[model samples]
Target: MTDPLGAARIAIIGGGIVGIALARALTLRGLGEVTVFEKEHRLAAHQTGHNSGVVHAGLYYKPGSLKAELCALGRVAIREFCAEKKLPYREVGKLVVAIDESELPALAEIERRSIANGVPDLRRIDEVAELREIEPHVAGVAAVHSPQTAVVDYAAITEAMAQDVRAGGGSILLGQEVVAMTVEAGRVRVRTAVSEQVFDRVIACAGLQSDVVAKLVGADPSPKILPFRGEYWSLAPERNDLVNGMIYPVPDPRFPFLGVHFTRGVYDDIHVGPNAVPALAREGYRWLAISPKDTWESLTWPGAPSLAKQHWRMGVDEISASLLKTRWFRKARRFVPELRSRDLVAKTAAGVRAQAWGRDGALLDDFAVDQVGPVTLLRNAPSPAATSSMSIADYVIDHFLTVRAD
Candidate 1:
């Protein structure tokens, strides 16, 4: 299956969920000679594997935008794909709760957007009794229940996609990281740790290392990727009863991440956490884990300074929460009062969101796609990416295919 002449139909850089989704999509569309390169020994080992597994219902994005459209479409597609594949999943739903009166406006906005995005089952409920009825221990004056929110093991979905790609005549190479990409004439030369590959079209789904890969081939990577490590803590076995399902806080409009809350995993475990703190490394995980070179580059970047200047207050608060585990548990306790400090335990698998920020310090609120030269780079695709993977594949392919599609 190696492209001996360096003439591949398409070459995907990463083997995460997004890359696998595209690989499958292209093959399904009858485009073979496709190859996916993975640095890891197996697929979905990074952000895809570490995600919270929430199949977003398109509640937070602008109604007519790509984020909304793709997620809405992708959610349905993913649900069907899971059902067809017999992958374990649950439409356990999620609650976007307004912990206080001031938060109600944000909750209302979420409801409005959800309705606008064709999420027909959104309902707002007031009265603590009702909130407690839905999730007995959760605290809130009101909540927006998105019945469409579901959970699944994304890694499983990615594995299924890789299998489909192989069955459909695409070859996926693992343990091979794309070191460089150079477009020569009409063909793209993709150099990896192991060998060189030639492709007509290349899709870089490098996730955390997307900027680096994109820059290797001459793309304006203005919006530098600032890896925000989202750390999580699963529930102590005794605290499993504290959460029935997903309980998300109303997201701050200024930020992209949904604050720390409760999510009952599809694997029969109820866990909470993911405090978004500025990560020292693009893939930073633990407390003392530091990459001085990356840290310096990230901190000294103009975009980083501007980004900090804009979101400094929120950044400090998130860092504080990360530094003090008690603060994280406190946020959870607000939702589920019975969730004590002891209920929190280290859950190592965490996703580092590839948060793309503009040079002007503006957070790219929606998914960003930039067409540079012959390559189409997926600049920013954060949460709900797994949910939106299929739709994004169509979108990406459709954009490129329509050029000569007349």
Candidate 2:
């Protein structure tokens, strides 16, 4: 007789917030066995641990998109999860400031999307006096205040979710890099550098390597993952009082990357930045952190040339900001006049965004997921993904997993 556990074994690749959340959700749904494979020695080592820690209010997504729906519902879910776990969740709010009359149209569009997305306690302030009441030191002709926007430690939340998985008898295998996958005999063989295992089914939330992992399972690779590095500068400790909560610019509607902004963490330390610049490698954090293979993969893609031709100006500006500290600080100073170059003295850890781009050069603007054989792939999940981790998990379980609780 064969082992019954083999019939019920389920594998999840990537040990970030999404994967751990999925593991816990599946275990709670009465799955007999679940295993999480993390290449890193610890979980949340990539995007989960490197983000600005803002719990998005679902204000910037398209009204009816998966990002909009999931982020709204997920924000509430995160609050509840934090409360239950005794984690810190601070409702410090957010202000999207429009510096001049030129930005009003974009700001108005954002407001429309926010309302349609059912964002609660969202208000518009056109008067500088009213804006002063919210962000006293800011300079903007108009602004949208999202009072429900909050912040939390996403890595901590991910760890807590992992605990739930462990408590529920699931296994988390660390430092296991998945190298290949072969689906046959109604089970998928998942291979790592050190070992190989056969699972009844697999779901990959591989983040930065999502495209590569999907390709291993025979998924289409039209939308290649392009790595964009977002580097941050920490505000001087004494200058932390410059901003209350988060202050953002009216983003360029044409692009997916949000402009440089100020964010106050749960620890009350403030950071300015995250300028979008092309990274030399997939996981590149510094300019010198280069990978010849990763660079070749990006440069050789059909979308790379077209995307460069389309947004070369913006790309140049982003690279300029990334290289020149003064240029970056000047952008942040537009909203907060008091912010000086000296205020942004400390360098914070940078994050590489795994942005998906089509062959025609359009940046994919929504959460993208698809199925290939016995594997379900979360191809693109950016920004509010941490806030929407639990919701995405529920979506995958309820829709993608055919082997559900009876």
Candidate 3:
């Protein structure tokens, strides 16, 4: 039988959730002969595996933006996918708490955004009694609760998507990194260490190395990636009672990162933290995992100076918290006043976020994509990327791939 997609070859760089999800979507639609190349031997080796596992409830994103639209659709798609696959999907809920009256305005803004984003079953709790009813140990002047915000294993989800890709006759190549690429006659010639192939189209969902991949396709490198490592601290099993579901702070409007928070995982293990700190390497999970080249590139980037000038105070505070357990503990204890110092027993594995920043020293707040000839580069996909993976795939296929194909 002839191939329905007319033997059109497609390549997806990166084995992360977004990449796998894209390949799965394409193959399911019989779009082309799909193949995914992952540099790591295992899928979800980076961002997909190392995350807080919280399914955001469209609470923090700007309404009408791609992040807002995709995240809203993606969560429902993820829930259904899990149900279909018999995977664990726990709607443990999430509460954004304001510890003082000073934070009420920011809290109100969050409530407004949540309502705008259409977060399901979102509630605004003004009275402390009502807040305490949801979380008895929580001390807050006001809070916004999203009962449908949930948690799941993203790595497992990626693997499940890979299965769908294979079942649909798509190929997933592990340990095959695309080292070079050249566009010729409206097609892309991709080269790896061991082999080379040409493709009708290529989409790079490369997370940490997204900018680097874009550079290979001769795309603009204005939005360089700045790796920020977020470290998590596991809460003591006995102290798990301090948090019912998830307790988050009113994030600073100046930055994109949500503040340090507590999350109760799908397995019922509670963890506190994910304090954001600048990582020395793209895949740096620890302070000691330093790469001289990566560090030099970041330090010498044009945006480095202005970015530092803008966020130096926050950088210092975050770094201090990362170094001092007491400082980290204090941040977590703000919402749950009953939290003791001993409640945080050990540190967990860290996850490095690939935050995209412009040459003007401004962090990109929404999901960003760029097109280079036949290549589509996902320049920036943070926070909700995992949550929005499937929807992102659908968006890419519907907007970029299918449009060009037509």
Candidate 4:
């Protein structure tokens, strides 16, 4: 007879990037016997699959925030990990361009906070000539260069991390969606659609459905997950050279979406977009794709009234930009004069950001995780999360051990 638990002391829910990375971390620490549970047949099916693959350079986050601190650390850690794995990655650099005087102030703030966050060689270049020399196709009144930034296939990184997890004696069960979990006698009992498993500890990283998973483990589901659809438009192959690097617009402080811009991915595709719009479904990618449960919960939640009141104006603007293609492209054309309605050749993909809204209807501005018994729930991890997975995993490990000791 075999020991039924599949050789792991702990179970990692959701084989997304964070969970896969955590599984790898646990194995590397010689704390083996870890199992990854993924509902999807393969890894990187959702958020990791839809990522822009821009390895952020630690700019644009508030000074001393988790996003800022972890990004500075993650850039180095991810780059090194890529190298060790012989994966394709580049420190290709990035630029946040301010189209006019009004946006310059925010650009300046970004620069200051970036420095405060310890990003190296970050500087403002007002000279049009200098800007043209770096990326000839991009046109802006001024630009801020983030020389430390890079791009890679984030899905590949997730896959590599999964590989490392298995190599280190851990296992992953694909197509195993954890339908329910309960704590009994100081252990975790996880019920999947196909099977049931028990572990000494459980860590869930279900991205869009984080709130639902949290509730399944007996944690309060106060910070409701709000889905923001970020749609992208890939430029025609002929138009790629015009957008030479990651050309960004100065983001509006009131909104989390970094405004539609140009990104030159590691695959040599110059993509534009990520217009932030309210997603009708947690996984809605197109118009009319609505999830009744998600829609009802958000509208009826006590916290949503406050959140809507706070960002009602911004939400309206985002929706306008999303529905009106002309309005959205006009934003991209600010930095690239050559951009036209025809420049957008392909609907590359879109991502749904899991924004956490509190019961009072306020947005959660930081990373949040909750644990009950042997089950841990990840609530909110947006933006630099892909960049900060390693550090986040370390923090989770520390918390798990500390709680276990107690």
How does each model score on TM-score? 0.95, 0.96, 0.97, 0.95
| Whole-model lDDT per candidate | 0.82, 0.88, 0.91, 0.82
lDDT for 405 in candidate 2 is 21
Question: lDDT at 255 for candidate 4?
Answer: 58
Model 2 spans with C-alpha error above 4 angstroms: 1-7, 254-256, 403-406
| Candidate that would win on lDDT | 3
With a 3 Å backbone cut-off (N, CA, C), the pairs that clash in candidate 1 are none
Winning candidate number (TM-score): 3
lDDT of 1: 0.82
Per-residue lDDT for 52 in model 2?
Answer: 85
Model 4 C-alpha lDDT per residue in residues 113-158, reported as the tens digit of each score:
7788888888789998999888888877887898878888888999
In model 4, residue pairs whose N, Cα or C atoms come closer than 3 Å (at least 3 residues apart or on different chains), thus clashing, are 8-33, 303-359, 303-361, 307-361
lDDT of 2: 0.88
* lDDT (10s digit) by residue, model 1, range 1-406: 2222233478888899999999998887775478888999999988998888889888888878888899999998998999999998798889889989999888888888888898858888998888888888888899989877889999999999889999988989999988888888867888987798777778888888888888988888677788888878888877788788899899875564658878889986877867788888887777577889778978777677777777789888888888888778777788877777877887656668888877776777788777655566888888878899999998987775334211
**lDDT, candidate 3, 237-329, per-residue tens:** 988888899888998754546578989998899988788999999999999999999999999998899999998999999999999998988
**TM-score result, candidate 4:** 0.95
lDDT of 1 at 307: 73
Worst 10 residues of 2 by lDDT: 1-10
Worst 10 residues of 1 by lDDT: 1-10
